[model samples]
Target: MHELIVSPFLGNHLVVRPGSPKGLKVPKHRYLELQQAAEADGAIPGWLHKPVLRQWGLDLRGQNARPALLVRDTVSHEYGRASYEVNMACNWECPHCYLGLKEDTGMEWSDRELLLYLLRDAGVLWLQLTGGEPTIDRQFPAVYSLAYELGMMIEVLTNGSRLHNPLLLSLLTERRPYRLTLSLYGATEESYDRLTQRRGAWKAFRRGVDAALEAGLPVELSVIVTRDNEHEIDAMYDLARSLDVRTREYNNMTPTYFGSGETLSAQALTRGGQRGVFTGCDAGHTSLHVDPLGMASICKVARDKQLPLLTEGLDGLSKLGGIADQALLRQGGCSGCQLSEQCSTCMPLAQRYRQANAPLGSYCQHTPKEVTTA
Candidate 1:
């Protein structure tokens, strides 16, 4: 059973147990002093009761009590150590996308509201906003504004196509938080265009990067490892060095695809004729994904909903505990395989390959196993 308590500092409602270590404590004299102060300031209404200080005591006397205090205590211990994904939309259509494809409609407002409330309530100080291109949504700016107001430092992952627009640059310039991550598919236009699948996307992305740099936005670059561009990794780093950005900060490419499962296949992905599951992920525990539909998922790579739809509010996110636990278990050929750390084995992608005849193809094939892990 959860009991609500009002925090003295934030003045927000927090659900905790009466005897839990996380519960608020007010001495009798202090309580009386606060009550008197409230009365003097005319802040006390007739509905307000007299101050009553209660001592902390565990109520373990009841039958059928299933360690409520223990559960609450565990939750409190992990209070601020959670991560969230705002959405799964991207402007580019890279060969490897874990979240699947974009729907005809945009994200619902209810889902956004639920995520906002949850982040605020859970005291999540950092949030990453992703998408088919989070910036493509007109609501992107508003969401950034709200995250800022609530004190969360926002990080954005984008293909850098929209940042070329002056208005968009100005908006991002005004409300900067951490930095924007730009995914670089290739160093040159010909190479980049081949990966993006859209003609002129390379030019647009380059211009977007220039706009971001001109606006003085802190930016990072991410490259996806693919057979087409695997040899260019060193050159990409050289380009980063010339740009005067942090070259060491570059993220190695992963072959995780974002759209429909129909795009990738296991036969195409298997290396050395050995099919194995991707392992060593604490995914459901430390990370979470909130899809456009407002459903909570473990990893963007997996389509399964670990928690119920967060329509009620942020508090509903607590329901994800069971899903997180279940994800720890492995099945099929993935069981007990040692390649977990080196392979970008996404369950959704594997399922997609199995459903269709698509093969598992990723930039990982071009990268050395050690370097890929590195």
Candidate 2:
């Protein structure tokens, strides 16, 4: 007779049943709910001796599946940082936007909430919420509040168009993000609107930025460096300084997942044209990216491919490691190059272009030509 077991791993939660074709990666609370329900019905979370798994030729790292004796990690108590694309659907299609404008094929709201609970259970200390625009999601409030209640530090990247939203602003003021990074397209409204291609976006953005500051939410600004707005770098700093907020200057924009430069317009410069070598990036180890539909990937650059964490359970997770390994491997000239620290190659950017045989899109003026010449 086959038995049912619930185990949580560092990467995923597994509910596996012997002889079953598939299992689910359940959320933490739901898993706990199942635990309580089992206890009520008088059954311990199923556990077999470690030898049983080896005997069956099964190789699995169950984070916290405690048998009468604990072996491997059965349940994970370690948490770090994660950035979820709350939803990929967007109102604005920025020319240089990485993910490109696409329908929300990501997970539904219900499942996302489950992921959040599971994330909390996994001990995630900081959570970054981003999207086509996270505030556009109807279920944003529920998700945001749940993460906040979990005591996770929240970082939000947004266009600031919706900060003035009454319900959302109210939620922001109450729960409050640890930091809100606002995208500043240009210093002037006309220039900003031209870049975003929205007629009244500057107004909405201004309103949102003002609203966030007025509500006492910590705010920072990112000046996107593109042809249309590259000249406004100093002005952007002035703007940030005037608002008494910190600023980040962005020069690189990941190409569309297809690795085509279709989205790259004059306003969006290519920041990866140099012959730089990939050193390393913080995709798999330090940070993970989850898209709208519960598809998890190592980073934003790898968004097109994702592991279905909930459906395939442990098998999906195991495969995900392989994917990250393949992605993290130093490809091309980077393998022999010693200028990794100086090379302009961003791992994600290199990975994005290498598979497609596509040329790196644009060159950073600051790239040291001699260093990458190798």
Candidate 3:
């Protein structure tokens, strides 16, 4: 396993340790020097040796201490983050899942490889692997390996159904992800199984969580709340505390990506917490999202700007910024709304709410009191 990676982040270069968030910024000259040292099998540069030990607790003093340093040679664009949905297939079906239809489909191995390289050329240093459940995808391991080898920090957003698989666990153990974000439906078996609409989902989820923690993998839990398991909300928090792992709560519900209101019925009245007022985001400017078939979009919620990455290659990203600008404009239902200044929901998300024919108070600032309730 490689000890550290050197890649371009936005405009600057950074030396980042796998499975860790902490990173050290390096100048262009030092970045080149480190690349040369790694390639020529030369001595560890004096400047890098101490920081490696101090930041990650890895020593470079011993004669056999040859830390595998992976360096990215070029970055043609400035995109620093991206999310790829490996496949739409999942083992369990939750009522509130934003992905309306879970289809077992994805790009072939050859196309998958091409997409990873395109991401590298586009300067994506932080890559997220998401899906209906990324672990259940057949090509997940290979995709993960290729991303890691390309020096991109990886975060796997999974449902935790297949984490207990020995072969999958072994691969993750050898090449750790920056973080494994597991979604927790409920604290108890009845609630868990009922909510996911699967028979043995609770048992499988528990086994996966236990195995992941036991292996000392970096794990974080996303406590998801819905009408089905809202009764166990307090118990869910207690369970996370007992497990002694990092956790966050997700209570906000949105219409499915396909513009369906079917998922809105599962929304819980209890507010999990504040997500802060949404000012704006660098969706297409610094980050982009890719679906299962290599189609690029501005962001998950805003699908108006679709780019054919497989056909256009990295050149497609150049148009994303402009697409982002047009999609974010206050138009349609939001045209000339006085409350647009203090609105928490962005235009793209508001558009989804409108398409679903949701309640007037659900996403519109026109109903201020209801907007704050969730």
The most accurate candidate by lDDT is: 3
Off by over 4 Å in 1: 1-90, 247-282, 336-374
The lDDT, on a scale of 0 to 1, for candidate 3 is 0.86
Sort all candidates by TM-score, best to worst: 3, 2, 1
Model 3 residue pairs with clashes: none
The residue-by-residue lDDT of candidate 1 on 151-227, one tens digit each, is: 45567878889998877787677666466888877788887888777889988988898888887888888755555
lDDT of 3 by residue, 1-374 (tens): 56888877877889998888899999988988888887787777777878888999987664221457778876778989999999988898898888988999899999999999999889998999999898988889999999988888999998888899999999888888889999999999999999999999999999998999999989899999999999999999898889898998888788888678888888887763244566889999999999999999989888866999999988889999999989888887677766667777888887888889988667764554433321
In the range 270-359, model 2's lDDT, one tens digit per residue, is: 332434444566465545777787777877776556887566543444454467778665566456545556656565566665554544
Task: Report lDDT (Cα) of residue 248, candidate 2.
Answer: 78
Superposition error at 273 for model 3 (Å): 8.9
Candidate 2 stretches with Cα past 4 Å from truth are 1-79, 266-279, 313-319, 332-342, 355-374
Clashes of each: 28, 12, 0
Using TM-score as the yardstick, the better of models 1 and 3 is 3
Score every model by TM-score.
0.63, 0.71, 0.95
lDDT of 1 at 219: 81
Q: Candidate 3, after superposition: displacement of residue 22 in Å? A: 1.4
